[model samples]
Target chain A: MASEIVVDKLVKRFGHATAVDAISFSVDQRETVGLLGPNGAGKTTTMRILAGLSPADGGTVQLAGLDARTQGREVRRLLGVVTQQDGLDVEISVRENLTVYGYLCGLSRQASATRADAVLTFFGLEGRANDEVDALSGGMKRRLAIARAWMTRPRIIILDEPSTGLDPHSRARVWENLAELKAGGVTVLMSTHYMEEAAVLCDRVAIMDRGRILALGPPRALIAEHAGRGAIEIRCDEAQRDAVRAALTAIAVPWREMGAVFSLPDEGADLGPVATLAGVQVHHRPAHLEDVFLRLTGKELVDD
Target chain B: MTEFRLRSVAGVVERHRVATVRTWKVALTWFLIEPAFVLVAMGSGVGQLVVEIPGHGPYSHFVTPGIIIGMVMFHALFDSAWGVFNRIQQGAFETQLTAPVTVTELAAGEALWGGIRGVISTLAIGGLAILLGWFPLSALPVTLLVSFVVGVQFGVVGLCSASASPSMSALTLVFTVMATPLFFFSGSFFPLEVLPDWVEPLAWIAPLTPGVHLARGLAEHSLDLSHALCALYLVAFTLLLFPVAARMLRARLVK
Candidate 1:
């Protein structure tokens, strides 16, 4: 499939600090790609450049085969961007917000109205069309933001942390809407901190750290490559650490320590000896994207 | 390969129109009542105390044009500075930027909207002047045209300031140190000739002075060479500042 988006060695700098280093990636048509990273990992900067909201300091971006640097207006026309910040016009009605954005996207007044209605219904916000956006709940506002982006019927949608602050139910609703978009074969590029969200929604996940992509692949593929099928976790205090390490070494299993817990690959390795060790608890489960992320980016908390 | 469209500006102007309509009560207070109060207090009350000026006829007539120009200046300044700043902070411009709208289009639309508003407010004060028979009816169109030019000029200036302002309080400093001082010293109330020798150069450099000169000349139907030069200076200044304003706003917004 032809790539709908291509970013080559994208770089962004804020004064002396480089926000996005020489990072490159692509999204195929009808494919969903996730930029998975912690805060200040340059995910938002990359998305902003792809969405034509910011300029790249070095490298090039192509959207639907058009150069983003020189053809920003055209790139924007083909993209529907939902930024991390809610961009809804609080002074306007929910429907009006979408309609006005549609008009800005070059739709006629009549077409804008129709598109607004369709998006409102799509986001399950038809009943609140006439209500002021400021009066809507946070979740509803997010839905409105997405619906407004959808109003343009863009071929590619870029969402920056689409479900960052939503509750479980609202996040589920957002996922359902995104799922619908996926079912309709819309190209999606999203940045997320939620490992589950990326695992569920992304066809390919690009794990990012600092200002570069550390790994990129399918969720299952990354887990298998970086974390194996499953892991045996041994939790023990400092006093019991030596006993646990000796037990794992005697069993000939490779183990890595993260804080108070030690993780070993679950390659049919006998954990009976480690489990039998006193003052240590064992947990065995399938490896997940979170584990891969932790392995790639370390367990230290990324300061916002 | 992508073709840029020109229709995006109408969308931005429409959005501003809708927002203005939604807040018509506040808009009316600023566009109409505030100017009326200034006209009454300065043109009428202050007019009563001052005797007849040398070149200008009556106090009320001499200051009427100044008050009208001040209205346009204030409206354009506030709309482009505080209004643009608030919209930027609220991500309003970002939302539009995400669409097919270019930064130049956004800046032009804002400047045009400010001019339209200045014209509307000018009409309000012009109507009052006509009702009271304070100025000649023949110069109404010219006065309004001058008011629009002043609007665009100051609108661009305001956007330039807004682009550099880091916070709302920083904008307060702009209003205090820049706008307030310009408002008082720009020959809006009395002639610049009455000021001290050192202040004459400052008044000459004030952005509002040429606008005041053109407005007063057109209002009184006394378009002399100096007033004509002032009008030319305003036209040249607007043409120069508009692109600068657009570039500055683009830098601040596109990041």
Candidate 2:
């Protein structure tokens, strides 16, 4: 596998604020990697640097081994960006918008027209070719933005929160399109705050927080390795809750306390004390990415 | 490489083309019909009051260049001001930034297209003036081209304003304090000879005043040294402005 994207200690500063701090990562060609981070965790900033939309305050960015600053156009030729905000022109018709973007990406008018039509069909927007973009739904506008990005046949596609604010149905459509891109061997690097999206769409994910990668691995492996097999909650009356926590923690057990409940990892731990009590209940389940996130990064992400 | 460059420009122009063509009615109305209405309304209604100064010719002739200047300024200013301002404020420029187009290419495409649009509008308005017996009728192409090029000058002024301005208030401040006054005092409406000598030097420094001077020569058929200087001033204005406007746009993009 060829390395398509390389960022070395990237940093971006906004006045007194350091948005991204010494972040380094790479995406291999044809790899669908996700950067999962909370809002304001610098995921969008990192993508902006890679897309050459924002300049890095420190370090270097190379796309397919070309310097982003020195040979930006060369690198841009290889990369397609699907921004979080939909940037489609409102007054223009759907088909006309794509054709213009196609022309900007080195296609002739006729070529752009043909490519625009094909893309319209590909995104299931064939019926909207002549309609104004403002007349389309939120989903259609997002699809158009995605289609416009891919009009140039880029070697790598970077999506910054592709499904940030879409409905479930619209999200499914975007996911389907992403699956098609993956099947066709297009390298993808996506940033998303949705744990389920990262777990489902990405081959591997880097869990980011506070401008650093806290954990990096495949979804199942990360969950299993960090959060264990599952969690069991022993919910008890107020008087019994402390006794439950004390019983669980007395054996050096890893546990969490929330009101009248004591949750512990179900990794073959001693549950003998729990069985002796009537209010104690053991519930086992498959671990999830959310659990892994909670265990490794703490619950502060939601707050941030 | 050249092909790619062309494509890059196409990309910027095309992104706006849908809106551009769809708003043809608006552009035509602003550039063509509205200007005609202003010319006809202002020319006929105001021409009756000219009291033609003996050597300066009919009141319409004097107002011809004034209307031409006003039309070009309106076209360019409107195009660059509202359109470019909206794109920047609404974050549409980000789309162009991600495309293969260079910032220079994008700015150039936009400014030139605006100039072209201004040319179209001003020509229609100029035709109305001619039909109303403004000038002798040989000043068509020179008047049109010179006035069209003026679009780039004023458009750059507006684009740079948008790029550097933190908000529309700042943009408005620039027009209020500087741009509007320059237009009024730039010898567009009245003869420079009428101005006091102290204010004369300051008015000469404004951009489009030279545009009026050059067009005046062509309209009157007297290609003298002042006319040549005015023509040269226009070329210089365009050359200096384009790169600076592009730089301002680039600065806005990364930040």
Runs in model 2 with CA error above 4 Å? A232-284, B1-7, B14-18
lDDT score of residue A188 within candidate 2: 94
For residues B2-78, what per-residue lDDT tens digits would candidate 2 score against the true structure? 22365566566565555666777776777667767766655576768865745566666766776777667766766
Q: Report the C-alpha lDDT of model 1 over A23-134, residue by residue, as the tens digit.
A: 9999999999999998989999999999888889999999999999998887888899999888877777888898889998889999999988888899999999999888
**CA-RMSD of model 1:** 3.3
When summed lDDT is taken over every stretch of 10 residues in candidate 1 chain A, the lowest stretch is: A295-304
The native-contact fraction of candidate 2 is 0.70
Show the colliding residue pairs in model 2.
A104-B11
Best by DockQ: 1
**Per-candidate TM-score, chain A:** 0.88, 0.85
